[model samples]
Structures are given as structure tokens and as C-alpha cells.
Target: MSPLNALNWRYAVKQFANTTLHPQQLEPLLEAIRLSPGAFGLQPYRLLLISNPELRSNLLLHSMGQNKVTKASHLLVFAAVQQIDEAFVADHIECMTQQRGGTAEEYQGLEAHLNGYFRNMSDQEKVRWADQQVFLALGNCLTSAALLGIDSCPMTGFNPEGYDQVLGLAEQGLRSVATCALGERHAEDAAADLPKVRLPAQVLTRVLV
Candidate 1:
């Protein structure tokens, strides 16, 4: 399907069917999220593709009674880094060197710039910035899932501290910012029949120039 058609057909699936995605369908969606853009390409987050039933059940407890947390075939947890420091900048610089076939010394200038930019932000600002990056990946997941004819429900109604504790995110210096449930929609899902409510294009967009 074309992107617009896929989007038109997609909705936040309220009920998932008892169907699992074939690896062929799931892989490409994962690739789209992996390739999602971020500030400075630091990708200050980790995407947790969870299929473990026990873990999902535990997460449901923290999800503010959202059954989709466990009802879906898979759960995607977007965990943002708790902090961005000199070490984080250094790691990105080394990755750039290894991937681009250059010496770390050659990227010292870039590294310094990144470090300086992040240093200006307060601790709270740093986490807020990371959370924004995670949302970019979440948007990619939703669009890719739709294009692949998979059902998805993106949510942020859960308790973050509970999720962080259950997922051991704090130990990893991460915190759950959002989640997307993925699967096939149930045939009886009334939401599928509802017309999408959106602002008209003219009202939602503009040309400044």
C-alpha cells in the first residue's frame, strides 16, 4: 500500500487478535525504527522488543490497566537515557570513527561541540531531550507497522517509575518514556470502523513564506 493509504487504514488498535507476526513482517518494521533519525545521531535511547509473556504481564500492572500491554503479540518499550555526559559524547565519537573509517582524533572537534552543547542543558533538560529522540523512533514504529499491515497502539499512560523498576532501566541509566503494542487487530474491534477524526489539511498546515 502507498504511505497515505496505509496511514488511512491504520488506527490505534484497541483489541488485538490472537495472532503473532511472521518474522518477515516484523523485521522490516524493526529496521525502520533502527534507522530512525535523532539529534546528532546519538540515538540516546534503547528500543526493547519484548515478547516474554511473564515480563509483559508484569508490565501490564504498571500500565494503568491498559490490557494492550499484554494482549498484543509484542511490546516496544522506548527507554531514554537518564543522562547525557562527556562519556556519552565520547562513545558517539568512537562509533563515528569506527563506522566512517576515521581516527577518533579526526572527530575531536565534533566531539567537543557535542559535549559543549549538552553541557549547557540542565539535568532535567537532558532527559527531556532524550525523550524527544525516543518519540521519533516511536513515530517510525507506528508508520512502519501500518505500512506492513500490522496493528499498533502507542501509549504513555503508564507509570514510568514502575516500568523503570520492573524493566531494570534505572540500573542501565534508562527510563521508559513510552510503549507501542503490536499485533493483528481483533475482528470485533469497533475502533476499526470508526472514521478518523483529524484537522483538515488547510487548518493543520501552513506556508510561512
Candidate 2:
């Protein structure tokens, strides 16, 4: 099916069936998110794939009473890196050097640029910036799931601090920003039959030219 068709066929699944997505079905969606773009290519976030029933049960408590948190086959938490500093920028540059067959020193200019950019932002602004990167990954996950004939529900109606504690994110220098629940929609989900509500193209966007 075309991308447009896949998107039209997908929705924010409200009820998930008692079905687990096979590894084959789950990996590609993960790859799509792995390839998601981010500001400065820093990709200042981590994807937490949670499948442990016990952990999911713990997370459900922080999920605003959303059973989908536990019912979905897998829970993907997008966590922003709490630090986007010189050390982080240097690491990314070194990675680029290794991947592209160059010396880390050769990428010093690029590394300096990224470090300077982050240095100007206040701590709170840096946090917000990293959180924004997580959303880009979330969008990629949603689209990839739809294209792969999987159901997904992106959610933010949860407690972040609670998640950080339950997931031990703070010590890892990460903070939860958003989550996506992946699985098969329940057969009796009324939401599956509801029409999508969206604004017309003219209202939603405009041509600059």
C-alpha cells in the first residue's frame, strides 16, 4: 500500500488485542526510529523498549490510568538525553569519524560548532531542545508502524518524574518525554470505526510561493 493509504488506515489505537508483535514485525519499526533526524544530527535522545510485564505494570501507574500502557505488546519510551554538552558533542563527532573513515581531530570544526550551539542555551532550554528531538523519533515510529501494518498509540498523558524514577532515567542522564504503544487493535475498539478528524490542507498549511 502507498504511504498515504497506510496513514489513512492507521489511527491512535485506543484498545489493543492480546497479541504480541513478532520480532520481525518490531525490528523494522525500530530501524525507522533509529534513522530519524534530529537537530544538528545530535539525536539527543534514547529509545527505551519496555516489554517486561512487571515493568509495564509499574509504568501503568504513572500513565494516567491508561490501560493501553500495559495492554500494548510493547511500550517505547522516548527519553531525551539530560546532557547535551561538550562531551556529548565530542562523542558524536568521534562516531562520525569512525563511520565515515576520518580522524576525530578532522571533525573538530563540526564538534566545536555543535558545542557552541548548545552552550548558548540555558539548562532548561537545553532540556526542551532535547525533548523536541524525542518527538521527531516518535513521529518516525508512528509512521513506520502504520506502514508495517501495526497499530500504535503515541501518548504523553503520563507523569514524567514518575517514569524517570521507575525507569531509573536520571542516573542514566535521560528523561522521558513521550511514549508509543504498539500492538494489534482490539476487535471491539469503537475508535477503529470512527472517522479521522483533520483540517483541510488549505487550513492546515499554506504555500509560500
Candidate 3:
């Protein structure tokens, strides 16, 4: 099917099959997030791949007892760094410059540009910027899953503080921004049988001309 048709078939899956996604199927979905575009090409997010059953059960509690958290074969946690310090930004720019055969002088110039932009922002602004990068990865993962005929649900109902503690996110310098479950649709999931609901193009779109 074409991208548009695949999108039409996609839904926020409420129930997942018991089966896990094969490694072949799962790798592409992870790659999609890795290659996702982000602000200033500074990818500030991390994807936590959770497949342990016991951990999933604990996560369900933190996610307000959402069954999908446990039922889905894979739980992808999208996390962002709590702060974008100068050291972090400088490191990323230096790595990219080296990969492209650029000199220290060139990289320092780029790093200085990014440092100025981040330094001028307040703490809240910095957090928001980092969070936005996580969202971009989430969007790419969702779209890529849909295109691959994988069932998924984008979720944000979890207790952030509880999750951070359970996952030891503070040590990693990361905080949970969003989550998504990936698996096949359950055979008896009624929601999957229903037609997708969406606004008509005319209502959702506008033309300047």
C-alpha cells in the first residue's frame, strides 16, 4: 500500500497481540527514530527498549495500570536530557564535524553558535527544547510503525516521577518524555475492527488561493 493508504489503516491500537515483534521487524522501527530530524541536528533524545516482562509489569503500575504497557511486546520509552549543558552541545558538534572531516577550528565555530543559542535560554526553555526533540523522534517512530503494518499506541498518561525513579533516569541524565507500545493487534480487539475516525480533508485543510 501507498503511504497515504497505510496511514489510513493506522490507528491508536488499544489491544496488542501476545506475540512479540521479530528482530527483523523491530530493527527498522528503531532505526527510524535514530535517523529522525531534530532541532539544529542535535538529537537530544534516547530510546529505552523495554522487553522484560517483570519490568513491564512494574511500568504498568507507573502508567496508571494501562494494560497496553504489559500486553505489548515492546515498550519504547522516549526520553530527553533534563538539561542541554555546554559540554553536551559541544561534544555532539565536535563528533559531527570530525565525521565530516572538518577541523577543530570549524567545529569550535559551530559549537560557539550553538552554545550562544542554548546559553541565552532559561531553564524552562532548555527543557522545552529538549522535549521537542523527543517528540520529533516519537512522530517518526509512529509513522514508521504504521508504514510497516505494526500496531502501536502513543501514550503519555504515565507518572513521570515514578518512572524516573524506577528506571534510574537521573543517573542517565534523562527524563521520560513519552512512550509507545508496539505489537500486532489482538484478534478480539474491537477497536481494530472499527473504521478510523478523522476529519475530512476539506475541513482539516485550507488553501490560500
Candidate 4:
């Protein structure tokens, strides 16, 4: 199906089927996030894959009893780095350089430039920067799932402090920015039959020419 058609078919899945997604179906979703576009290619986010039943059940509490958290086959928590220091930027540059067949000196110089740029930003600015990266990843994941005919829900209705504590993310210097639940749609979900709701093109579009 075309991208437009895939998007039209997608919805914020409120219920999920009991069947788990196969590895073949799951890998592409992951790959989409791994290759997601980010500002300056910093990719400052981490995707946590939770498939354990007990853990998912525990997370339901932190997520304010969102049934999707426990019902979905996989819960993806998108997190951003709490801090970006010189070392982190340097390491990322080095990895990219190696992948692109660049020399050490070339990568080091690039890293230096990145470090200088990030160091000049305020703490709030850094947080905003990282948050934007997480959103990019989330968008990519959602689109990918839609194209694959998988049911998903993009969620931001969780307790961040409780989540961080339960996930032990502070120890890794990461904080939750958003989450998504992926699985098959429950057979009896009434929302599945609802028509798509959207604004008309005239209201949402603009012609500058």
C-alpha cells in the first residue's frame, strides 16, 4: 500500500490482540527507529523494549493503569539522554566516522566541533534538544508500524518520575520522553470500527505561492 493509504489505515490502537508479534515483524519497527533522523544526527534517544509480562504489569501502575501497557505484546519506551557531555559526543562521532570509512583525525575534529556547540547550550536547551530527537524516533516508529499493518498507540500519559525509578534509567543517565505500545488489534475492540476523523485539506493546508 502507498504511504498515504497506510497512514489512513492507522489509528491510536486502544486494545490489542493476545497474539505476539513475530521477530520478522518486530525487526523492521526497530530498524526504523535505529535509522530515524535526528538533529545533526546526534540520535540522543534510547528505545527500551519491554516484553516481560510481569514487568509490563508493573509498568501499568506507573502508566496510570493504561491497559495497553499490559495488553500489548511490546511496550517501547523512548528515552533521551539526561546529559550530553564531551565524551558522549566524541564517542558518537567516532562510531559514525568508522561506519563511513573516515579516519580518526577526521572524526576527532568533527567531535571537537560538536562538543563546542553543545557545551555552549544551557541545561534547558539541552533537554529540549534531546527531547526533539526522541520525538523524531517516535514518529518513525509509528509510521513504520503503520506500513507493516501493526496496531500501535503513541502514549505520553505516564508518570515520568515513577517510570524512571522503576526502569532504573537514572543510573544510565536517561529519562523517559515518550512511549508506544505495539501489538495486534483486539477482535472485540469497538474503536476499530470507527471512521477516521480528520480536518479537511483546506483547513490544514496552505499555499504560499
Candidate 5:
């Protein structure tokens, strides 16, 4: 199916059936997240995949009792890194050398440049930047899941503090920013019958020239 058609078929799935996505079905979705675009090629967030039923149950509590949190085959918690420092920037630049076959000498000033840029940002600013990057990745995951006929929902109605505590994020210098659940949609989903409502393209677009 074309990408537009796949997007048309997708919705914010609120409930799920008993079906689970196999690894083959889930891989592409994961890949899409891995390939999502980020600012300055810096993906300052991490994806925590939760499959344990017990952990999902705990997450459901923090998610305001959203059943899909536990009902879905897996819960993907998108967490933002707590801080960005010189060492972290250097490590990423070092990784670039391995991928692109360059010596660190060629990248000498890159890490410090990034460090200086980040140093200008407050702690809250850094977290906000990471959170924005997480959502970009979430968009990729959701689009890939839709194309693969997997149901999903991007959720923000949960408690971030509760998630941070339950997931022990502080130990890893990460904090939950957003979440998405993947699975098969329940048959009784009334939302499936409703037509998507949106403003027409004319009203939503503008031509500068």
C-alpha cells in the first residue's frame, strides 16, 4: 500500500485484541525508530522496550489505568537522557568515526563544539530538546507499525514521574518522555468505524510564492 493509504488506515488505537506481534512483524517498526531523524544527528533519547507482564502491569498503573499499556504485546517507553556533557558528545563523535571510517583526528573539534552548544542550554532546555527528539522517533515507529498492519497508540496521558520511579530511570540518567503501545486492535473498537476528521488541504496549506 502507498504511504498515504497506510497513514489513512492508521488511528490512535485505544484497545487491543489478544494477538501478539512476532519478532518478524516487530523488527521493521524497531528499525524505523532507529532510523528516525534527529537534530544535529544527535539522538539524545533511548527506547526502553518492556515485554515483561509484571512490568507492564506496573506501567499500566502509572499510565492512568490505560488498558492498552498492559494489553499490547509490548510497551515502548521513550526516555530522554538527563544530561549532555563533553564525554557524551565525544563518545558519539567517536562512534561516527567507526561508522564512516574516519580517524578521531578528523573530528577533533566536533565534540567540544557540541559541548559548547549544549552548555548554553539549561538542564530543562536539554530535557526539552531530548523530548522533542523522542517524539520524532515515535512518529517513525508509529508510521512503520501502521504500514505493517500493527495497531499502535502514542500516549502522553501518563505520569512521567511515576514512570521514572517505577523504571528506575535515575540510575541510568534517563527519564521517560513519552510512550507507545503496539498490538492488534480489538474488534469492538468503535473508533474503527468513524471517519477521520480533518481540515481540507486548502485550509491547512500555504504557498509563499
Candidate 6:
């Protein structure tokens, strides 16, 4: 299907069928997330793909028993770094060096700039900034999933604290910011048949002259 049509057809699937996505169908969704853009290219988040049934059941408790939490074939948790420091900057710089075949010396300017900017911010500020970036990645993931004909539901109703402990995120200095449950939609899902409601484009958008 065309991207526009695919988007129009997509919705937050409330009822998932008992089906697992093929690897071919799953690969693009993962790639879209891996390639998601972040502020300053820092990518200050980690994408945790959870397929373990036992873990999903536990997560459902933290998610207020949202059916999709356990019914969906795959769960994608977007985790933001709790803090940004020189160490974080250095890691990205090193990865860039290997990916682009440049010396670490070539990235010193960028590294210094990022390190200084992050260091000046308080922990609260860093977390807020990282959280914002995670949402951007969430948007990308949702749109890409739609284009791939996958059923997805974006969720932020869960308890991050519960998730961190259950998923053992504190050790990694990551915190869950959002989640996306993906699978095939149930045939009886009435939500899938409802017309999407949105304000008309003219009323919802404005172009400054």
C-alpha cells in the first residue's frame, strides 16, 4: 500500500490477534527506530525490544492491565538516558569515528561542544531533554510501523519506575519513556472500523506569511 493510504488505515489497535510478525515485516520497523533522529544526533535513548512472554505479563501490571501490553507480539520500550555527561559524548564520538572512518581528533570539536552543553544543565534538565528526544523517536516508530502495515499502539500510561525495576534499567542508567505494542489486529476490534476523527486541515494548520 502507498504510504498515505497506509497511514490513513492505521490506528492504535486495541485488540491484537494471535499472530507473530514475520522477520521480513519486523526488520523494517526495527530499522526505522534504529535510524530515528534525535536532538544533536546524540540519540540519548535506548530501544529495548521485548518478546519474552513472562516479562510482558509483568509489564502489564505496571501498564494498568492494558490488554495490548501482553497481547501484542512485540513490545518496544523507548528508554531515555537518566543523565548526559562527557562519557556519553565520548561514546558517540567513538562510534562516529568507526562508522565514518575518522580519527577521534576530528570529533574533538563536536565532543567538546556537546560535553559543555550537557554539563551546564541540571539532572532534571538533562532528563527532560532526553525525554523529548525519546518522543521524537516514538513518532518515527509509529509512522514507520503504519507504512509497514503493522498494527501498533503507542503507550505512555505505564509506570516508569515499575518498568525500570522490572526491566533492570537502573543498572544501565536508562528509564522508560514510552512504549509501542505491535501485532496483527483482531477481526472483532471495533476501533479498527471507526473513522479517524481530526480537525479539518485549514482550521488545524496555519502558515505565517
Estimate the TM-score of every prediction: 0.97, 0.98, 0.96, 0.95, 0.96, 0.96
lDDT of 6 at 115: 86
Candidate 4 achieves a global lDDT of 0.88
Candidate 4 lDDT, 1-209, residue by residue in tens: 57998898888988899989989999988987899898778888788999998888878888978999989989999988887888788778778877988677877777878989998999999999898889888998999899989889999999998889888999999999899999999989888889998888999998899
Across 1-209, the per-residue lDDT of candidate 1 in tens digits comes to: 89999999999999999888788888999899989998988899998989899999999999999999899999989999877999988988888888898898899899989989998999989988998999998998899889888999999999999999999999998999999999999999999999999999999999799
Q: Give every collision pair in model 5.
A: none
lDDT pick, better of 1 and 6:
1
lDDT of 4 at 52: 90
Each model's Cα RMSD: 1.0, 0.9, 1.2, 1.2, 1.1, 1.0
lDDT of each: 0.92, 0.92, 0.88, 0.88, 0.88, 0.91
Kindly indicate the candidate among 4 and 6 with the higher TM-score. 6
Per-residue alpha-carbon lDDT of candidate 3 for residues 4-82, written as tens digits (9 for 90 to 100): 9878778889889889899999998888878899888888878898999988888888998889999998999988887
Candidate 5 vs. true structure, TM-score: 0.96
Model 1 poorest ten-residue lDDT run: 18-27
Q: Is candidate 3 or candidate 6 better by TM-score?
A: 6
- For residues 77-188, write the lDDT of model 5, one tens digit per residue: 9998887888779879988999988899898787768888999999889878888899899998988888888889999999999999999998999989899998888899
Off by over 4 Å in 1: none
Clash pairs, candidate 6, are: none
lDDT of 6 by residue, 50-117 (tens): 88999998998899889798899899999988768888899999999989888999889999899889
Q: Relative to the unseen true structure, what is the C-alpha lDDT of residue 111 in candidate 2, on a scale of 0 to 100?
A: 82
Q: What is the C-alpha RMSD, rounded to one decimal, of candidate 2?
A: 0.9
TM-score of model 1 relative to the true fold?
0.97
Supply the TM-score for candidate 2. 0.98
Candidate 5: worst-modelled 10 consecutive residues by lDDT? 82-91
